[model samples]
Target: MEVHPANEFYLQTREIATGNVVGCAGALEVVPVSQVRLPPAPVLDVHAYLADVPYTTSKEARRAVTSSQNGIRGDAGVDISDHGLTLDDEFPDEFEEGLVQEIYRRLTRTSVSDIPGPEPESLVLGNLRQFFQCQAGEIDFKWQELYGDVVRFKGPFGEDRLLVSDPKALQHIYQTSRYDFAKQAERREVSRLISGRGVLWAHGHDHQRQRKIMNPAFGPRETKAFAPLFSDVASKLGGKWKDFISQSPNQESVIDMTKWIGPATLDAMGIAAFDYEFGTLDNSDNELGNVFANMCVEVFGSLSAKDILRQALAGYLPKAIFRYIGDNAPNHRLEQLRKASAVATKVAKELIDGKVEALEVGKGKSDVMSLLVQANVSEDESTRMSEEEMIAQMRTFLLAGYETTATSLCWALLEIARHQDVQTKLRHEIHRKEREIRERGDRGLSASDFDTMPYLTAVIKESLRFHPASPSTYRETMKEDVLPLLKPITTLSGKVITELPVPKGLKVVTSINGYNRHKDVFGSDSHVYDPERWLVPGRIEKTAYVGVYGNLLSFAGGVR
Candidate 1:
């Protein structure tokens, strides 16, 4: 059942729906039941209410109050002494208090609420420049300038949307009350069209079931076993690059790493994810590679107005109309992507069938699909996934695992190229590791050897922090929630809020970019990409939420 935000007066009568938590409606004001048409509670010992409360040391509670006051209440537990933050000082200069007044007066008779954010210049057509900036790769600077830790604005559909950068609030959203917020429906729909009913687009129980079956294959042992495949694919790409450079008269070919990275990662994914070989590094016309490459060009390359219109409105169109247009329209790119999807679908089905047969014969391979099949067959009938579900999982992993890793590596290399000192230091570390390995009479560097190189690990973490593969992720609140603030914020009305009461159906954008560079959490140099900070003791501070691999939100936290 979906839960909605409601007033506190209804709390006694309102039952929280199964799998949902109702949001506190007017807790910001904490109005009494007597004022809301309910009989006042008998004035007995109010102290009894506190009797069963969990034990919290006064010092800890004081620290919490100091660090995180939303200003709605005075007793919000936060450690203010360490924060050195002020909400009034943080409000963007562009925000106009008069705009909120005008909005409440002219648009709706509802009471105006407090949150520090600039009223967009135009309500109906909100932030068109944001779309253009995202396309042009100039979004981070604009977002940083337009708002501080949190921003609220009218969305394109005239609904309220929020972009939050606060780490504490983010922890609640991503981990504490994760189920209360879900991936945006529209985004999930689009992903579903592209990748079937896979883990990427799955929600609730289906997602949990899929992840449970798939997680072990991606665990440390399997990942280490696949290391050689990665090295082989990377070496093949490097050898090709070397040959291309040597052929040039200047002995330095200007190659587009982006072009090479895709094929290399695809080949790696082929072996790692499915135990298949693409041989994409040696063959430009490799069927799956060509399909993917062509699809990328068709989607991202210059498009005619008609194609653009069709793509933009595809989400809103009926399923039949959308599929008809896709199948019959003059969209070469869409056709290629469709073909790639079809290919993936076919290959996944075949692989799963083969894995099932292999497992029956007690000769399963260590590839992800085989391990998953083995687990599925071993589990109880209730826990087993359908064959179609297995196929969907393969398609999801094939695309996501390779594409995201390749893009991140490309970004890391680009940063290394930009910073000569970092590159040199990294090279030295690699050489030192190689020497140590040779002295130990090892054939090559093992996963353990790689772990010994602190500098490389630092560089990768720094790169991920600076250039997260997914810059932003969207969520829609399924229930109203009270967001705890690490730093108290001053609302437009000048009231200090201790906790933010969010309305249901609210759209939120979690900025991975913004969180990675949060000032209070990471200190003044958060924006700077100095990997050596990781080497310094206590320089890399931990946050309320650490993501999947690192404290950074690059991989997001919880289920992701």
Candidate 2:
């Protein structure tokens, strides 16, 4: 059952076959059951709903809001809060007021409804952008801005999906009712394409079992041990880049980070995760590296209409149907996926075989895959994963450890390249820290030393905040539930709702971009790439636990 934000907390009943966005209490809009025609799409009147609302507790964000000409709502030439943030004194300008009543007149006509979520005026076409942005674009935050925190948008064939960003709402989805929600059938089917029935693909009890068996491998001891291994791989990458730079004219080269970073992360993952050496950084023409890189290109790089349609329409079918489609499809993207999946499976099997052989001959291995193998050889059958499941886990880990990490490094480098000041500051910090450490008789930075450098840590956090590699995730409700809200929302009938009523079988989307750049959470400049916010004391106060790392949705929280 795919659960949407409107359903988990804000239970909604939509007429999906028709174009009707049926409202339920606390979900979209509390609409009374009636045959009513929707009027013309009114002009954007953000001021009406957001009037006199405090944007953030962060002093920096408040300052940004006050300094802006049009204030928080971005109404261009209109000054919303002239004397600065006092509720009773501040009001939307006359031009803004006319805009509000006009919208109110147009909206109030619709009777009471539930889940009074702000929806796109252009309907299905409008929601298409939300899908794109949620995957890997920048425009999805606009939906959150236009709608309240919990937004209802159409997916393939006008299927309702609630893009949830509200902190309290996300808490329920991620923590309070986590087990109550399951992976959408489409997501699971798609996961099988690349990762098979790995931890990433499994849901419910299967997910719990896999995660419990594998989580211990990534504990503090393994993580700390992996650090020096990562540094060595990074040094190999740097050494290769230095050679490239030396060969160029003027001792300078335009090294494409994309070409280099993917392999570097692959090498790092190889040694750290499986104790397998890919040697991709050392050899530019590494065959396995090229295969994975080509796989990525075919999957994410190409922008053909066929690819886009396939990605958008991915959720339209279940696993059995998707399997039929994959087997029978005549063309490119699916074939590319199949090829990559085969290669990944083959690689996983080899790694598993090596580990099994090593363990049999009394050689102990400590890598993640080895750990799983150890569990499989355990006397307890409950702790063991099936052979296919083990292969899937390896495939999942390889892709995650290679592609996502590589993409993140590229994004971080891009940000550094764009901002010379940040680059310079970071460079100075690295050199200064190295010199300081040498003076203390230390050779170089340790795993712990990385933490001592504030600017470097800040930059990494900010980068993750801005560009989460996997920007969106989905869930479906298993049972009827109600969602509590951190912020109350107003319905079409002028009533305010705090908690939402939810029913089972609704599709929901958790937007990493929307939450990371939430105005209330990170201040008005949340959209801006300002690492200084992390330095400031009161910039981001507190919220529900959002991430497993650096307070980011980039590393999602809760169980798998």
Candidate 3:
């Protein structure tokens, strides 16, 4: 149960490093948890102590306001007079009477309103405009500032939703009572069109089963084994770029990274996942690759009118009816996705058949597909994934395996390119590591090598923090619960509340962006992109339920 800060969030219990699997061949030696050292907790700033100002007077009252000028324009400012409440309904004379009578009067008359939150515009086509207006990701910070960590709002689907950014509340929902909340129904229904019932879409025991079967393939030991494959593919891409530049008379070529990374990642995925070669980087024409690439652009690239309409309809329409509409409609994107799914399925089936045949001939390779098929045909019927389930997983892998990793890699490279000092330091560290490897006669970078590189780890962590692939996601509560807050908030009625009561059907959308750069947690300089923050002791806050990776919600938490 050793956990290194660099890979803690990325590696799950399912991905155990020590295992008797095909790719692994045998158990790898485990690093003791006690031997893994993390940076010390960040020290608190002097100004941090000023966070506890009482709201007993108007001057001392706190409000989260977003203003363009020095002055706020509206008359709707929070009233602090008498703690912003009216006691007109209270029986003044009776309030001073017997204790029992006064208590009864107060209980019957007093009301506690919901917590204040950001106001969205009228449902012009069902909050579509509001959703689009929040393109800059600052809305989360604004809302958290104005209304405390947990704020209530009318969601895009015309339901009361809570957008929570508090770490304690996040821990409560994600870790303590994970089963009490399920994936947002609308999103899950739509996702099934692409992912089917893969582990990404499974819940409870079903999810656990899928993870168990697939764990060996994703374990740290197996992932480290794929390092050479990654390096070889990457080196080939570098060579391609060099040739392209040489072809240009100016000794420089404009390479569209958007176009380039996809193919390179596609090749990487093909080799690493199934030992199949797409050769996309070599400019080989791959039908499945084209379909997969196009489908990604159509679904996850941007939000068009068609996408917005389809998403809005998903909230109301039944999955079957909506799918029928998608199938029959004149939407080009929808049609492409359907074709893509068909192609992906056909390819997955062929690959699995090949692996099975290889196994029969006693020539099985140690790729993910072979190991998965091996696990499938074994005696453990309950843990084995059916053919359909395996295909669904294949689809998930194709989409998730390449796109997000490529995006993160791009961001990391961009950041390194922009910061010369950071780049120089990283290069020096790389040289040092190379020297050590050469001296030790190590063939390639190992898991231990990755663990020891602090600068490289910091760069990757900073990139992930700066730009999480999924900025926000929704969850619907299935059971009533109370969320504890790290910071207490004063309500409009002047009453201080430490816990919030969440209804069974309440919708919660967590802001990963906001939490990553939380001022209170990460200090006032949280918004800045400084990799040095990771080196500085006490710069990052300790959070109870901060996702899977090093207190970052980038990869999300819970079973995911």
Candidate 4:
């Protein structure tokens, strides 16, 4: 049937159920079929849409629709329209109650039967765009009310699509490598923009290889070497805050902690991760550092931009263009990336040259760059990294090692400032650790001390959980298959959905925020700011569990 593109009914049939034909023959007759029973339409609890439903044009739409309706309404007793028929007449005094009871029964049954409902005919692109336009604060409230950590909603614009927000489902998705769920492509695009072709952006064996190369740098010895650096950075920051408070005699000055902490973190990562000087400790406005700082801010802020610009194009813009437009356009991201690439490449080249010079001069070095340089120089042709790859790795180090830690630190401090008691306890722990170290005649607190600081570790874990820097990760289906999970969901539109016979290239989102805050695993107080949750026996407890943060999917997970 030739359908009107602008008509809602027409679009619903075409977009939601591609093979279903919905047409008007001169307003008097609905042609071709004497009777038409569309799929039992999925209902959305929320006013907005964000989930997506799969669509296909090859299926016999009439049979699929009939099958879905039968699943929802039951086959033996109900007629087609009666599938979604309200109980208004059945129980006049409690009509709504009866209808709700019927729905709940259907949902429960469907959940067990593993039958997905029809694609939601209601959720459209316009509705979704409007949903996004709503204030983020209001959206948060809406999400809480609709899902409340356990509810399911129709995907933004898909047939029989639903988004389940239960902790058990989240845990199942996170833990079951067999299902092979992954993050959405939009998130990957963001990762590529920030981290380039490093472990964060790579997949499968490439990701594994990169992780192997980088894993040594975060080992016990290397991590211990960085404790002093962390202490130094934290101490300097505390001192700076003290000075700022002291200067505010009237308490009129309000510090933008995010601003200060961002740079401080850049500085810390430089020393701790690469043994390079960012000079943020001295509050020195180094040219390269400033550029780096600005670049980070720009990419994050681009979340609100309207234009969709390719990341490559944004990375290649001239520095002058970035300086002129600032963070206003997609081009700004490109320019920032370009500058970062240049700066990182230059540093890598310098490190390589320095390693060569050091070898000639007969000196040994222990820093990460030195190790990487030595490895690269000594490797045979097959294993050796190109200069470009070396630079990419260095850039990845700077991007991944610094920003996340800094963001986490910022959130931790913010939470502490808000929860003075937690702050006081943390400080006491820090002081006690320091005293113990001094009593042992240790010049500095050892890495063991950092590990032993229970409250401090708890504080860090809680902060990471509450305000994850990378709130989501993306992955794509490598093959079509059924995904088994703890909770089975029936789509709004009916279909037997399992590992969603997902086409090979379909994108999926691994929502860190949603997974971390799920109530089933975390308890009813999942939303509360409680560091005690991370502590067991007055020490930071490590256990085998599935989550988005601790043993969670905060970092990407896959076969490789």
Candidate 5:
């Protein structure tokens, strides 16, 4: 139930204290609904903000640009790396950023009638509602269909934003040039608030360093080793459900699967990732569970105007202003966000030292957390991760891994229910596979065993396509670049272009669902949930280097 405040998903802390500060667990800080006001983006003075900072060298210039965001020395000073997005890294570092911002302002303020998109509902709100549909839920596929693969929609305060699903463009954006486009500054700031400077928060070299060390523990080999742990969690969940049914006098009850599924995934992540048991499945750990559930309800459950404005401001406002709102703002959503994170932070701290010690003594469990601990203790001192960074990764995995897995599983189950034939077919395949394994004298599925069943794999892939956990990823251009398109389209001004020229600071939305269901890629029946599509050879068109699996953008390429 814990919602990630990353893009309406993650919230990183400022002045993070390593020491535990105990509060009333799951306590609600009630604030009047009317007290919440739409925060205006700060119109900061360029010269005044930059005047006092030292900028003699290239490094100092970049530092000043990052540090001066606070109208003082800003601390969250990570920069988007020049990794995949083929950004021009040759520019002089010792340059005035104020002039750059002013130029960007003029360009953004100028007319952009070249790109085609739907009209906005309001000048102030822009196409935010349409964007929200794509991000939160109720994806507006009609826009892509009408405006072609690339649509230039309005962002907050009527700034131009691009919604793109073209294959070549996606390749350029996600793979060919990943570092050029990073999770928008606001998204990173929010993630930092929630998890500190973990992999999710770290980008560029920091991200590469963190991912390199932890990648071993998340690979196929490690996953196969933990299959038994997953089986145990599933068995526990099934027993709990059985008890629920038995307690009913009618012996049948309409149970909310979400209520159970959320906690089940939490327990799974706890054991698999950290080797810690949250006991949320049976409702024993209500402190963390209730707090997270309340946060999910408050943030994701409804489209409150207040919460919407908070998220919208993140999209348009400067990082300094956005972080200010995140840290100092008064709202029910933030209260629950802080509370849930506080409780989780307490748990992560409790687990960190033991994980380190266990690994040091060579008695550590081969869980991902332990691997990270081992990595931290690596002989290469320069590459080792700090305990704080380790803690951030733990929190990152929980927020990113747990709810997302449960939600996807629930979606898979829902899809199965919707199509009875698929359910029956999937069940038959699973039974046959299990029987085959048992006949070989094996008791249950290993992670490798599951891979051998083609149909089950298809069903899972289909579910991922149909209900991608992350519907879309928000990105910002660090520099001006041309996005090449696989399919060309005419602009509003009647110019046919194969490549799109995006200016600096342009906000682009890489549409996962749009690409997943694109007619050219997935065929005319892309919108349909047909697992048989995978069964039929050549039914799906493969786009090179887009997603981590099945040519889908679910595992979004380019975290930076």
Candidate 6:
């Protein structure tokens, strides 16, 4: 038998040389059978040896070893050198074969299909432009066709290469906590236009510090204190809607609930978070409130010339000029943004300064803003926010409390309206809880009360999952490395097969809508609005697989 040199290591074993040899009295001593003639050895090749192995190749061998050590497999293979044979010669059992086949099937099933043949770069760019211009309703279908579930394109206005609609890949992306991924420059510009350099746009330590200071504002006690405020605002808005509907006889007046709720929630945020009022709930045209509302409408309405110019000179222009142009463009809408930011900031400053003065004067105040002021001033270390930082923190709280919650509520209502059964179920749950609280003589529902309403909470959760207002998030890879996507992908031209090689500086845009509706993870009815799915007794397995936004990508992932 010709021995391959590679197998020489396995062949030269003590057991094969001598069955038993006495060392001194009864002790066994290993002896080499040098005189024994061995068959001429065959040249050993690592590639050939690896090819003959049960795993197909050494790459698979390495993967198996890694997986086994990581507890991803049950057992290590048995040693065969003692039996004068190599482990690679042994065949796998039928069960093991079936298991391997099943795993491969599952993996192949989830693998991303090759992107169709590479068209002209201009074609891709044109498609993207058309996509951006498309109505919200038309976007989903068009996106699905262009890139079935995983698509990558370079940013139209920046250095970022964007990846769209790969949930498992998104999960891995969001797991990193280094704050390396951040809002794109365009998004930052937009946020600044709306909320200044607040927590929404802050990075690193500054963001953490701001979040700490702002925590108390959203604390259970603080949030519950604002429950009456929320009820008041909701009631007022409800009454206005009722009156408007009553006045419109015969023909129904089609109000954009989206437009109506923006101001109402703005009013709620002012009163609940800052102990002030936008007076939007009272139907009063408060200048600040009107300016803020108009700014939001205008900013979102159409891309301004300044926006176009900023996009054109993304990396070339100085940051200051970009911000200035964004804040003070030639358009009146831009002027409105500036005015809104100025007015809101001025009001926040006044509130903080007044609370500080009142506290110094021995007067007492216990609202969220007052508490924040107290906290901000009392720390020896790690407790201080600069006046500017305080302003940013307050602005963040205002935006977070107002915009996010209101958007969530709006989507929830819209979903509930469309699915009457779900609406009825949620209403029943809410009414039941309210009745319980009333019977127990609790004057108002607390944060804990909200927690206890499982069905209501589920409905909110489901709506958030379905219609996340910010449907996509952007990130830039900070380091150069091969990023193996959770799902493997074949290239459009069939030249390259990869999971996804996300090069450094590539911009990655995660699609919350796609991930939330992933069929593999969430099942066939993933697209449907079904709060009942979350109401099961135990934790939902599918939801646990989510990597962003507390296992959902509704909220922006990472620090920001």
Better of 3 and 4 by lDDT: 3
Q: Candidate 3: RMSD over Cα atoms?
A: 19.5
For candidate 1, the 10 contiguous residues with the lowest summed lDDT are 49-58
Q: Give the Cα-based TM-score of candidate 4 against the true structure.
A: 0.66
Provide the TM-score for each candidate, comma-separated. 0.75, 0.77, 0.76, 0.66, 0.77, 0.70
lDDT, candidate 6, 67-120, per-residue tens? 533322222353334323333325445434443443332222211123431222
Q: Which segments of candidate 4 are over 4 A away from where they belong?
A: 1-193, 242-253, 302-305, 308-330, 359-366, 378-383, 493-501, 536-544, 547-549, 556-560
Q: Rate the local accuracy (lDDT) of all candidates.
A: 0.65, 0.69, 0.67, 0.52, 0.70, 0.58
Per-model clash counts, in order, read 23, 31, 7, 25, 22, 3
Global lDDT for candidate 2? 0.69
Per-residue lDDT tens digits for candidate 5, residues 121-202, read 7877787765664444344488887888888888666777888889889888888785888888887887877777898788
Model 3: per-residue Cα lDDT over 1-560, one tens digit each:
22222211110011223221111112112333345443322342313211111111111111211121122111122222232232222424232223223222222221112466656555534444555446535778777777878777765544557778888888887888867777877767555667678877788888888888887788777888877888788888989899989999889877777667778888888898899887887764777667766466566555765566666557677768776776677767667767776787888899899889999999887777887788778788777888888888887777666777777777788888889999999999989999999999986777678789999889888989888877777788888677888888676556577877665767688888878878777778988888888888998878675688878888888875
* Model 4 lDDT at residue 503: 36
Tell me the spans in candidate 6 whose CA falls farther than 4 Å from its real position.
Answer: 1-127, 137-149, 157-160, 239-256, 302-312, 362-368, 375-381, 399-401, 481-484, 492-499, 536-540, 543-550
Best model number under lDDT? 5
lDDT of 1 by residue, 1-560 (tens): 11212222211212123222222222223333344342223332213322111111233333443254232112222222222322132333223233222222222111113465655545543543353235322454456555556666655534457777778888888888857888876666556655777788888888887777777778898889887778777777889988999999989868898889988988888888888787888798876666666354455455554443444445457767766665566666656656777887877787888777877888888777886677666667545777767777777766666667878988999999999999999999999988998999986767888789999999998999888887778788888677877777666656566567776777788878888887766668987888987788878777676577668899999764
Cα error, candidate 2, residue 90 (Å):
56
Error of 2 at 371 (Å): 0.8
Instruction: Please give the lDDT score at residue 420 for candidate 5.
Output: 97
Q: Is candidate 2 or candidate 3 better by lDDT?
A: 2
TM-score of 6: 0.70
- lDDT for 544 in candidate 3 is 70
Q: How do the candidates rank by lDDT, highest first?
A: 5, 2, 3, 1, 6, 4
Worst 10 residues of 2 by lDDT: 2-11
